[model samples]
Target: MPLKQFISGVAEFSANEVLQLDSEYQTYLQPLSGKSLALTLLPIEQTIQLQFTDSRIDILLPNNRADDVGSEIGSEVDSDCHLTIQLSALSQLRDTNQLTTLIKQDKLDIKGDLSVAQHLSALVNGLDLDLTEILTNKIGDVPAHSIMGTASAVVNYVKYVKQHFDITLGEALIEEKQLVASPLALANFSDEVTDTRYWCDRLAARLAILEKKQLAGDK
Candidate 1:
């Protein structure tokens, strides 16, 4: 299924059913107080605007940019940080099942401020949104295969992000991999990699020039 369609369907279902279980879903929003997240879906070239507040949740989807999708879900808690997620690889995450497979394959590429990403992952992992039950009741048929197979994969991704990035949902940083907390470090590494590639090309060009010069001298 296309990512946009899948996300739209999920959003529709979530809007109706999630509101009914407001108290239950509120737990997931606890980490968002005063936080903002920019979620970019690379494949679809779409972005979702999210603002996490203690009392209200505002999700702006591509189709409805002027309106918020889920706005009546939470209460004012505490404002602390911001997170940005570039879903450059796992655009399939729009489907819960595909998200599981991508995570298992280690194909999801998430880059951002490590601390913020980690915290967001933790919040998502801690959510008790029993999607199976919700879908079964809401859609009248649960996507059992997709949900069960992908649940652990999704959880593992969160764990990996938390551990590797040093940030958890509650603003807690894991002790290990703290070095990744600096986004500049990642940028520097990327720059070095790019530089190495440039130098390799330069050497190849130099070798070609020397070979041509030798051929000319022989002539």
Candidate 2:
């Protein structure tokens, strides 16, 4: 059927996309040049071994490619340095420096080898993707610059609005607290009201007695 053919073509296209990994990683080959390290993600228990050589880097996928470990299998590739980290830790890292800081603070755990951690940090830190250059290539320099400037302005405006909003909310909270009576204050107010009512009732009774006495004297 035509629908089946379309699905098959999509699968074939994805297969070709996976083959393009070499070209994509070639740009990063310079910094990751001499470092060979293995990173193991716990819980799911997957190992990603990156071996850098004279020519290109080889990535050993744990379950799928055990044979690639070859002569280095249990020696350099497997036993060199297994950096164990949680998947959650990876998500929390905003940049390369955050990982190193967390590690130094003892918030992030690095076991097996210290060299692995150092190599990983250096490799990540050395990576620099210049979005300005990429944007310039896609669009003209002037237009790209204009777009970036507008984006920066919008971000600054949003931050300004958020800051004002937080200040206004804090002021409103203080005003609300001042307007509302505390339990102790309310109790004191209630006692005063009861005392006023009692005094008023006593005054009324004394006035009635005085009026009766005046009537009797008139008779």
Candidate 3:
């Protein structure tokens, strides 16, 4: 099948599903006041760009495979550096929802800003697309590497922070690792991981708040 046809089919499949997903996302972010998240689904292997402005978020959905979807959120008065998530291997993960999940989980290599990647990761996970079921029905047996590799990457990132920055951000970061690795692990752990969805929501909220505060302080 042609890429366009495939993408169209995927979009059709996700259209109704995305509404529920977005609602779940909003519910997950209920604690965050005055913040909005925009999600854009595009053709395979397209770049997902993000910009920060004042008061509103601008999300440009990719109209064609070659086109890029640029998204930005913040205030118009003062903005932070624009972040971009380029999907170089989008086509590879396009046909298989499992592969997409693997990429989001960091099982596949993501070459870009890690912080932005993490934020995108959280955003993708928050989507209520029922990817798990899709993967199970289409592609039986989830790859163990998908979760393990992501867990390892998070672990390494945490270690790097501790060794270089010497700033303690607490267990939330670690809990993120666990949640991505095995969301069920959250139930086992008494820490912040207990609320896997909340962890991602809080991370995005705190990051936005911190970014806004830093911009303010700079002014």
Candidate 4:
């Protein structure tokens, strides 16, 4: 698939899932609710707006892009806090879900309403939870524990093999093909050869002069 097709405008994706995700968030955050804030998210290029209230969360997408303008909040809205982050950063958050980590690394930029931004990061951090705990409710505790352990081991084994292959390929290329070398070592070898030739020429000339002097003295 093309890069654009594969990464189909984050704003559009979020707008579709906003209802479901907001419902889950609301269950957790029952108290202290209102039009909490109007959030503006700029994923490097595309812009998305999120408005939080006691009732529900509204998602706003771009107007120019026909593809992303389907939801009610797709229209223009006032931004309470503006955040700029790369599309790749959002992808990373899918696994880690620690917005503070990105903020610490300077991968995410926030402006306007510092408190609101910090709250948003906390909301995102809440996404990271133990899957085993949720699964145990549906299945038995022992089964859920076994499943998670097996899944984790599989992921680790795949990662280990990938890492081992990368290191092996790099070493093979350097040692067998001689693809990499030190420029300083080559220069040192050249300089030593030149010095040896100069010394040998000087010694040969001195020996010739001594032999000629001895011949003259004998005559």
Better candidate number, 1 or 3, judged by lDDT: 1
Give, for candidate 4, the lowest lDDT window spanning 10 residues: 28-37
Residue-level error in angstroms, candidate 3, position 54: 14
lDDT of 3 by residue, 1-219 (tens): 567557555664564355344446544333322332332223233332333222222333333322334432211212122222234444443334454565576545433333443444454556666555544555564654465557689999999977765333334445544324344555568565658878899999999999999999999
In model 4, residue pairs whose N, Cα or C atoms come closer than 3 Å (at least 3 residues apart or on different chains), thus clashing, are none
- The candidate that wins on TM-score is 4
Task: Provide TM-scores for the models.
Answer: 0.33, 0.42, 0.23, 0.51
Writing each residue's lDDT as its tens digit, candidate 1 over 67-151 gives 4565321212122332222355544444445544665666554344444445556554555666667666655554765776688
Specify the poorest-scoring 10-residue window by lDDT in model 2. 15-24
lDDT of 4 by residue, 29-113 (tens): 3331443344334443555655666444555544435456563332444566666675667666444456678889877776667
Candidate with the larger lDDT of 3 and 4: 4
Would you give me the overall lDDT of model 1? 0.56
Query: Of 2 and 3, which scores higher on lDDT?
Result: 2
TM-score of 4: 0.51
| Model 1 lDDT, residue 172, Cα | 42
Q: Which stretches of candidate 3 lie above 4 Å from their native place? A: 1-19, 27-58, 61-87, 91-116, 130-219
How far is 202's C-alpha from truth in model 3 (Å)?
65
Candidate 3 at residue 151, lDDT?
A: 67
